[model samples]
Target: MGKHLESDGPSSFSRDTVKAIISQFLGFLLDAYDLTMILTIAPVLAVVLFPPSSSLLATFNVIFAYSLTIIFRPLGSAIFGHLGDKLGRRTDLIITVLGLGITSALTAALPTYAQVGILSYILFVIIRIGVGIFAGGEYAAGHPFAMEWTPYKWRGFISGLVQGGFSFGSMLTAAVLSLFISTFGVKGLETYAWRYLFLTTLIPAVIALAIRLSMKETPIFSDLKAQNKIRKSPFLDLFRKPYRRDFFQVMLFMTGLFFYSYSLFAFVPTILEHKPSVFSLSTANHIYTIGTVAAFFGAVLFGTLTQIVGRRRLALIWAVITFIVSIPMYYMLMYGASIGNVAIATIAVIIIGIIAQGPWGMIPIYLSERFKASMRSSGLGFGYSSGIFLGGWFSIYVPLMHEYLFKSIDTPTNVWFSTAVLLMIGAVIVGIGQYLGPETLGTRLSE
Candidate 1:
């Protein structure tokens, strides 16, 4: 802690730190926009690509594609994580941005099942896998790059800026989808509007790549590499010494975070699907748009809060609030609520955004501080990527569980009650986890 305090002295800020934060923020923005665009468009795409009777199947197909991506994310993270550590963060960042952009563009050109038969599905799966792999690399590099560049005193705020980009991207996606759908008839959207959605990824992807290209490797990683202090087996070494307990704690914390995140995100759209009266496609999308906007501000607010109060304290407070609010907020949305009611529900969603989503702002720093620079990339990559795997896949199963096993969607009340119960459980887990976690504010990168 004394070393951490020393590192927090006046010399911490630099022009390069600003560049790194902006570059990583842009990359996250693009990733978020692309991912959310796909999620928002899935329902509409189902109506377009599949037979009318197979709409549900189409929804499942999209989910399956997403599941494939989630499953492969860790592999991408591990592969690129090593590259980021051994080669350079800048190198990996550039490659991932270009790869993700190219894959997204290719997705725009893919034919429908009607046109290509089974080949369309195959192509979709392959494209998603490619995107998933690149996305895996993006986070592995992006977070560390931002953390390594910034001083400890402002790490939470800078990291929040990076995380905030995701919310902005989501907001941008919702706006894009809304505009496209409004302008193009649903039939027209099915034919060509979706293609434009894919094309939009190209702009941010190119920008992120360019920004990253101009940036150098983190001073921290560079210094470590210069000393030949790189770990021979970073994954193995992550648990070998002082890092073992911290590693496990971060892993558990991340797992709870992702579980609640995935569950909330997956369930929201599905629940919207079930409640046409309250959430027509347009209306539901509007809710998502508003929620994303809320998330953007929430991230900024929480990030700033972390700086003032410390990361661990902020996380614990927000997590408890999220847990208490989960059930009631969701129940309100489940019944035939008005748009205004849904808007109110956004308050809870915003809090979730702040707590579950906001802690990620500090994660890059938290993980980096937990390990030496030699193993930082591998530790952060493995921990965060593994959390995504567990949380991401389990979320897919939640919809399936509710739809097939519980038969909860049979009635409005059942749907509300079931989702509320699931959220309650997730909220409790996340809240407790945060309380027991370490506070890494002002931690030294070189420690």
Candidate 2:
């Protein structure tokens, strides 16, 4: 505890702080919109962008588009993290939102396979990488920007409030896409509905960008600037002495979250859609939307609880719970014979969402508290984005593993079982990481 330990009323925070948090929340919505929409629309993209001549090529095109975005995120993280650390979080965020909005608009209007042949697929991927780069900068700047402005006492709750914005975005994307598909029908969705989905992302991006531009620099960053103590190269400094342990710990924490969340949210939907006999696309989307909405509230609840239970202990408890419940939950969801059985399965998934994503809501504060103001943005950015990029790749391999290892016993039940095993592994890893780290609930951010 230091000068920054003083408590302040919620209203004591300046308008700039409130505005910045709102902008960050909106930016998160846009980020989730693009990523989730890509996964949701993968089947459509495969049919429209790839030649219908071969099924293998179609799968490749869809997977390639999704994977490229995940792979390039870290590159964007490093680049934008440097700029954010040097210039300012606000300035870097402005550039990131603009890039996301413009690139998304362009991709929405991209040519179909019929018009441009292979060039259509090629251009889609190139622009997807661009979107990933822009998205890379968003959280790196936004999280630190929001967390740095809050008082120590309220950090846990506010961190959950801010990060919970991600679940809102996920729910919105799923709901809207489901509505669009229902209105347009499957044939129409493949034809033009997908284009409009990307186009809609521009609205939030522009609005969030405008609010960000109107906002002031974070109080922490401003104070550092006034003292002339800001690092000239904070990105490099993140890997040097003193800061390395904090960076690594946050990286491990985020890695477990990415593995757990991405596997359930990203991997499950795709698997369900591809196996239509087991679940329709719209049904899958509805399940995801419902699950994420529940998760959002879970995040808020768990985030608040961190203040009482301690961050490390809370994370460990949730990890173990998720690990134990995963297999039985999946078995119910996959093998149930009646609608009641399906309902139970869906409820099981929702429970997993609650515990799995709950700890994440506290991450912004935890990460922000770990670094000095000089390199906070860069360190958080690199650690968070790099963890996600690394953990996200497992989604790519999961499909292949399902195809090869379980080829003989290829059933929906087996697929769900495989998902459970991965979730269990994620829980074990997260629990161990939390055990290795210190309790950050009472730690004070450097002023």
Candidate 3:
């Protein structure tokens, strides 16, 4: 009886662990929803703010602003990651959530371009930067927080739950936009739709803040601190020695994953919406909604698979599947034969979502396992943020390259074809990197 009780204790689920996972998941959901909400409104904003004269340029400017935010994310991660490592995860999570909530609310209240001229654009950029800083910290802090609290056997599931939040957030944003657009009309949508979308950020952010406030520091971090084993300069320790190879491996892994994700999630919907020759706005929205739902289950599936096969092998499989199927997926979406064709296209979109997004579910576990608990937050933050920064730029540049090189918008098929090729290249790199990377299954935090 004593032996059975002792054995079961390690696998038992506790209230604190559940709380930590929910808090982290909620924070991720808010961030994901806010980021995608602005993206959904970008087309309408371009017409309103830039009109016909500078519409494309306005769209590019918004993309550039988003890219800048991605650039600053690493800085936020570094700052908050250090604090989380040195002080406590709960404290850093609270700070980030509060900052994100304030900035999101402020974004909703900002003046339009007609009302404030260049100042409106300037303020928008500034707000995005503020949000970016907090967003950067939110992601880095949450993954490690959840991973630390979770039992080793269930880490993959918890990690998937954290990753799955973004897809759920995206779905929620889609549902909200669908409702708002139906009731408000396009003109009303242009004026007030974005404000409501921004307002949605407050719900999860405030909830996460409250939940985090009630939580204690993880046992692993606390134990390390008690032993005086925490690194004095976590960033320096990551880059200077012993950890550099692992850092590079993380960068490679993230770069490939981010490249696939940012392109598919951020660019694909916009491309489909703006290019009516391919699909109407309503059709595009339906596709996105369906695709996002598919991605959510894909993440959950991949997360479960990781627990059985190990992170390295699962990542390799996802990459290979994406590379092989991307062209057919793009082809179906580009040229639908009938209503049945649209159904087929929808399935293709779902498969693409699964392949493109599966890597993310495993990344938190793979990254967290690579470092000692004392420096895990900092190392993972640096790796993840750097990949986002690089991948964000790739997403921006690829479309610009398509426009410049092809010199025509009339050819929707070519544009999508180009996008698929770019994604395939990223997949190949990910597959190769996984082959070269180390397997980190069943590793303990103390290692």
Number of the predicted model whose TM-score against the real structure is largest: 3
Per-residue lDDT of 171 in model 2 = 82
lDDT of 1 by residue, 344-395 (tens): 6555555545544655666666666666667777777777777665566754
Expressed as tens digits, the lDDT of each residue in 334-412 for candidate 3 is 5552233567667767877777777778767778888778788888777788777567686466666667754353263
Model 2 TM-score on a 0 to 1 scale? 0.92
* Clash count list over all predictions: 0, 0, 0
Instruction: Write out the backbone clash pairs for model 1.
Output: none
How do all models score by TM-score? 0.90, 0.92, 0.93
Error of 2 at 145 (Å): 0.8
Ranking by TM-score: 3, 2, 1
The lDDT values for all models are: 0.70, 0.75, 0.75
Worst 10 residues of 1 by lDDT: 408-417
